[model samples]
Target chain A: MKEVFTMWKNTKMVVLTAICGAVYAAVLIPFKPIPLIPGFTEIRPASVLPVVFSLFFGPAGAWGSAFGNLIGDFFGTLGIGSIFGFFGNFLYGYLPCKVWSYLSPQTEPLINHPALWLKYIFTVLIASLGCAIPISWGIDWVGLIPFSVLANIIFLNNFFVSLILGPILLFTLYPRFKKWNLLYSQIGEITSEKTFLQNIGFIFILIGCFGGLLVGNLTSLGHFTGKIGINLIPLIFSLILGTILI
Target chain B: MSIYLYLERNTFIHRLHPVTKIFLLLLFFILLLLFSSPLPIILVTFFLLLVSAFSRSISNLRKIWKLMFILFTFTIILWTIFLKNLNYALAMALRLNALIFTGLIFLSVTRIEEFTYGLNKLGLPFRVSFALTLAFRLVPSFILSAQTTIQAQKSRGLDLETGNLVQRIKKFIPLLIPILATSLRNAELLAIALECKGFGIKKKRTSYLDYKFGRNDFLTLLTIFLLYFLLLKIF
Candidate 1:
């Protein structure tokens, strides 16, 4: 988290952030004509760029993803809900590297082994959910889109695109980035220690995000009843607290 | 393929200071959200249209009218299906349209530099603002590179249009890899260039463009506040 701010101090990181953002927007803007949900989202195959850049550029990637989505929104979808879109994209880019660091600190982001592949899948799932929860909740809470509708679409879109494209991008580009000394690990000192607080925070993120999704779906679909199901403010707070701690 | 919506007009709205424009944008967003009923929302939409016309940004709106129409129709249909209420659906659709139109006007009037400068004035960090402006400028070039890659790939017998969604997406891999690689290489060069030019050596920096807080900005801000209160009272 500190690196997210600290990376701005380094000129290369700043340039990398801009590059990541520009590339993402470049890929994204062309897809604007093809809408999955008009005025809400599109067929965003460029979603994988953030995940891939996350593994390589770390904090810069997170900021890049956030800014890239903002730039994309400037095309048409720029509105009050874009604030959530910004944060959602930041999480989409931020969570993958953080989860990967926690899951396998020593190894590079390669997918040669079955265990590594499973970890990759889990990492993408968390990142996808991390991105979906806030945007869906915020939009739904704002009375624009339903929580159940958006949450599922965003999750599936991010998960499937990243799951398919992330590995190929990583496999081809990881070595090149490492050789160029542009990987976040090479540029910044990453602490490998697994602290107790970090483990707990990770669990909280899992529970809060997944639980919010489930509860949101159930309540919106009329499967859940009572006061607890009606209000999502508590879950959102937990999710925020989880990310902060993690 | 150009992403920028800014129209170079010498209208009053275009001449307003960046901060004032940003404030007005936020104020309109709040106003839109404060009302869920169709009548008030429609009024706001009319007001926004008037503003767009006065600002000479209606052409920008025209460019995105198709998108707005589709969004309006789909939102109404979706909400109607979900909530079983046609009036509610129409209201929601109008609300969404008003939001989009407001954003369109903002973008149409505000340049990238003005936007970043406004954020910087509003307490965003210089580095962040610089990166944002840089990213905005870089988008067109990246798009150009992507187009070149697509053409090169097509010449090499790559088929992008002949597949289902998944297959079409899979075809993008070849296109993406080359553009990404080139961009990464260019990033390294850019970083080195910036470092050589003493990009971060000074603690403070000056802008090339000098935007003054003129009387127009002040008047616009006051009018916006008054309009907001009046709308609140009327609603």
Candidate 2:
């Protein structure tokens, strides 16, 4: 949270934000037309960039991911989806460093310690799930795709790609950045205090995720047609949750 | 920089104000999504295709059509498997097609500068718009650097083509560093250049270009507004 203000005040961080955004869009635009599941699933090697950049540039990475996804959408899937895509990509690039640093591991380079690899995997999975939920859920609520299908597809797409490529890039870049003292973790202060607002934010996110999943399951099982007032409950809950987090 | 979709043509659609055309695109696109019935969706898709043809952007539209065809087929198959209704599948496919075509047609006709001008006139700050333009402008350099890096790595016997998913991804790591280094250097130079030009020196900046709302924009907006209501009444 403090890093965001730090980013704003620093000219170098501002320039890096724009550069990272351009790089992200450049990596993604080539893959825009190649849909793995045709309309829905995409083979985004660009998925790996977010996690890496998040760990590398911190808040700048998140802003870059948001803007990059917005620009990348112009290649094909733009309009309403871009709104959700922005937040979703922000989470994708944000949660990795947030969670990783929150866990408070003192490892210099993640590759130096084999045990920290699990943390990397865990970070990537959480980030991927965090990103997938908003995007798939938003698109489904907008009546574009089935919640279950899109959610699982996005989850798998981001998770596996990031799991595979994210580490390799991290491992490759970490030592280099560490030697250069360019790693975000090295320069930026990782907020360690668990504030009351953050706790409430996490609680809202938990409720949103659990409630949304239950709604998706119930809708799929024909228990509800997704039109019940109850469906909006989770959406509204997440909206509040999102507002808090932002 | 590779804004390859916008064809430099003198068609009437191309002549329409960027904001007006974007408004129509959004209106029709929303209408396309609002209707659940196959008839309206199909009608919207047809209308979009017709507009593309009328604009003489058939060649540009054809490129997107190829991709859209794949999307349509994928939608039909997926929906058929999940929903077990061919009619629903077809309708969903049409909706997806409509979404893609709307974007394609809009980008094909609107120049980047015109779109950015429209955005600026719509009250977006100059810095935000400049960042957007910078991102787009830098894309080709990033792509070129990526290509050069890949070529450089390939010459050193790195086989990116014949690897499994993990291996291929591993191959990409070598390419990432060079690209990042080059991009960072370029960003520094750009930042210096921008500061030298006295960016952010003034609170309010001005543009030389002005896009006026002519009769075509008015007629187009009115017609689309009426058509939206008319469609709602009919459907």
Candidate 3:
């Protein structure tokens, strides 16, 4: 019975995680005025779902959340992201989950001072070793994959310095934030607590509810126009606010 | 977009709505998946350049030149070494040149406001349209942030300039921490602001920017569509 419940919870978490990621990716479309970060990269913060999921559900939850991010890319109008992005963001979620799962709540997210640096070091290492070659080749950027090995080696070795700096962000001196009450009022204790199960459920539920709205709007507002860039600030700001306040 | 872009403004293409331009670009993108050949592609490039000239301001020529000098030169060398077919290489480079500039023609002149208005007219929601606006502004903001981060590292005596191939790459290690950290913080801020504004609510939004469909808009779309159709039929 316990196993059955765990499986059910896992399924729910995965579905929810993907939905949030999809929402983050999909909500980006109306901003047709802005060119994406040069070569199709954007500063997507939907990772909160994955990070939180990894913390709670372990590796499988991490996997589900990571893969779930393609929701927006697949459904959106541009569809350029759907093909390359499936794997591009998958690992982005997986690494954090793997790392955090590798060490649970008993261990602090920060191994040293300034949690930000360690996170960066971990990210670069994962991108180089786990993602770069596999992603480039998997996505059919075969020509570009030649540099992956070199890129990974050059990247991972420098992780030491940044790792030392990252701990400052976690618990040591990180700001408690002013907007926590906004998020806390509507949301339950499930997400607020640092437990693995609550975090997984909260992350997925949030993404689903959040990302779903944009899709619903897209269906209704068939044609969009006007200062696309300026309009986007609010949407991005909304996502940030949701994670913090809720 | 960077200040480097210069535009050539005129009636036909310029008058066409940004939403229309975006759709046409999409149409072309879909068209490419369906069809790609040298003659048809080259003809398309020629038409794009001609249209591009009329599409924006006169100042965008500098961007065209810089792209040709930098991206063109780089691609040519890379293609030649790998593909090793001089003709194929040159042809590919030219194609890239044409596509980039034509897109730049649109990018240089169309302000975020114009794009938003055009997309909203095309039936996209107010929130989605707004996100487009933020993404554009974020580019330069992100770049400035990256540059400042690098300079700070330099001040810390990172000495990135004197590094080897592996070591030179190592210099970038400092960037991911700060950039990603800032990004996470920004994400929280962006998400909240959007929700409070009633983003993603199902409703017809008011068009803040007025768009006029003059004689030029229709004629231009028809002429291009017809030309594109004819070209497609030819192949």
Candidate 4:
């Protein structure tokens, strides 16, 4: 216990990072979507604080980032679904952010090939749906959306948006705050962004479409819709159609 | 420090892998949603609460008390004016209470560190996991900073407490500008701190603590299996 406190003593960076996340949440309250956009309902992808924490502190920092986001949602975006805010925002913000960070040069050499960036997109896709499933459950049960059906429909609505949002946050915030020991490895690099990100971005958009289709279908198939084609056809169409364009 | 706010003892919940908990929570919530009726849900909810207490997460009840009150009061008010049916309102309130308490129990017993280790062990990158740790460390500091800033301003005769709703909100804005400004500058410094470390030099990184499976994890898995079957039965 003392070690934990001792590790953080005078670590103003940690305090400041949390404050940054809270402030981002506060300022973002007014920008929340009106539910008019089916999937693009969230206001800001505010990954700055989480990105900052991951870069500066390490894995522990990333968890704090998720916690910080929940706190942000609690004070800034409280709603009927406030109970689910922790999971919803945690997955939406931190999960994807961490995945991207892992694939970056900042992480130890796992799969160093440049093409792995393409694979990274799929990781984000898995993470998005991965986290979305739980969040959707919370959002659905809390009655945040009138029906669980509609909630599932819109669960991964912002999957692609977060994909784009997360990498940028990581690229921007990491270079400025990463620690001295870790910085030595990538001494000249400033941010995580580069040509890799551009190529990866395209891959992510594609993956999002595909992952969305997959989730959309699995959900509709498992769902008990008595009418023969009532729930089945449109569900496949939307997922497939979105995959093609997404 | 409060036992009512955070579980005091280590138990299955306090010991299970955080990532696993994260997954079980999702499954649990989905199962919770399969029914609209209150009878089985009432029984399930009662059982879950008992399990939470047994897991030594009774502290969560204290933290959720305020939100529970708000939900209860809001339901009552709405029911009195619109539905005119006490039964429906009470049922809805009970359902909501069950869901919220379930979440609180999950959070209170699980340490953020456990989750991070679980995350890293389960293939999440060290940098990302570290980000989570930093944020947890920072939250307490942030609250302190807010208090200090508020006290500093109040000492200078700032009238933070003496205005109407909009006026009071407006007053806070001026105070907020400095806080925001300081926070951003702090973010920049933190960014530099990260940069100073070899953050992106490698493709993989090592976590300080390694999370692995054990007897406690096995117990959690059994619990998850039992709960899953029970939920399926009810839903």
Model 2, span B1-235: residue lDDT tens: 3554777889888888878886787787778878876898877777777888988777866666677787788778877776788888888878877887788788888877788877887776666566666666677778777777777888999875565656666566676767766676555556667778786778777777777789878887887788788788899
CAPRI-style docking class of model 2 based on DockQ: acceptable
Best-to-worst order by lDDT is 1, 2, 4, 3
Q: Write the per-residue lDDT of candidate 2 for residues A1-246, one digit (tens) a residue.
A: 556555654444566677778898877754332345445565677788888888887887887788788778777666666777898888888877776765544444354466677778777876777787777777666556666787777777788888877766776667665665556666567656766777666556555655665676567446777542346456546734643563
Q: Which candidate is the best by TM-score?
A: 1
Off by over 4 Å in 4: A1-19, A22-68, A72-246, B1-8, B76-88, B121-125, B161-165
lDDT of 1 by residue, B1-235 (tens): 4469988999999998899999999989888888878988998888888999999988887788898898788788777877798998888889889998999999999998999999999999999998999999999999989888888988999986566667766777898888888888867778899989989889788888779999988888887788778888998
Residue A73 CA displacement from its true place in model 2, Å? 2.7
Worst ten-residue run, lDDT, model 2 chain A? A30-39
Q: Candidate 3, fnat value?
A: 0.00
| Model 4, span A173-203: residue lDDT tens | 3444343233223322223544554455435
- Reference contacts preserved by each model: 0.62, 0.37, 0.00, 0.09
Off by over 4 Å in 3: A1-246, B1-10, B30-37, B56-58, B64-90, B119-125, B138-158, B164-204, B212-215
lDDT of 3 at A139: 20
Every model's DockQ, to 2 decimals? Answer: 0.67, 0.41, 0.05, 0.08
Tens-place lDDT digits, model 1, residues A1-246: 778888999998999899999999999866432355556665578989999999899999999999999999998779988999999999899998999999998778988999999999999999999899888888876677777888998898899889888898899988888887788888888888888888888888888788888888887776877332246667777776767667
Question: Can you list the residue pairs that collide in candidate 1?
Answer: none
Worst 10 residues of 1 chain B by lDDT: B160-169
Candidate 3's TM-score reads 0.52
Q: Write the per-residue lDDT of candidate 4 for residues B64-171, one digit (tens) a residue.
A: 577577766665444444346666566666666776666676666666677567767678655545655565455554455555776787788888446543344344
- Order of quality (DockQ): 1, 2, 4, 3
TM-score of chain A of each: 0.93, 0.83, 0.40, 0.51
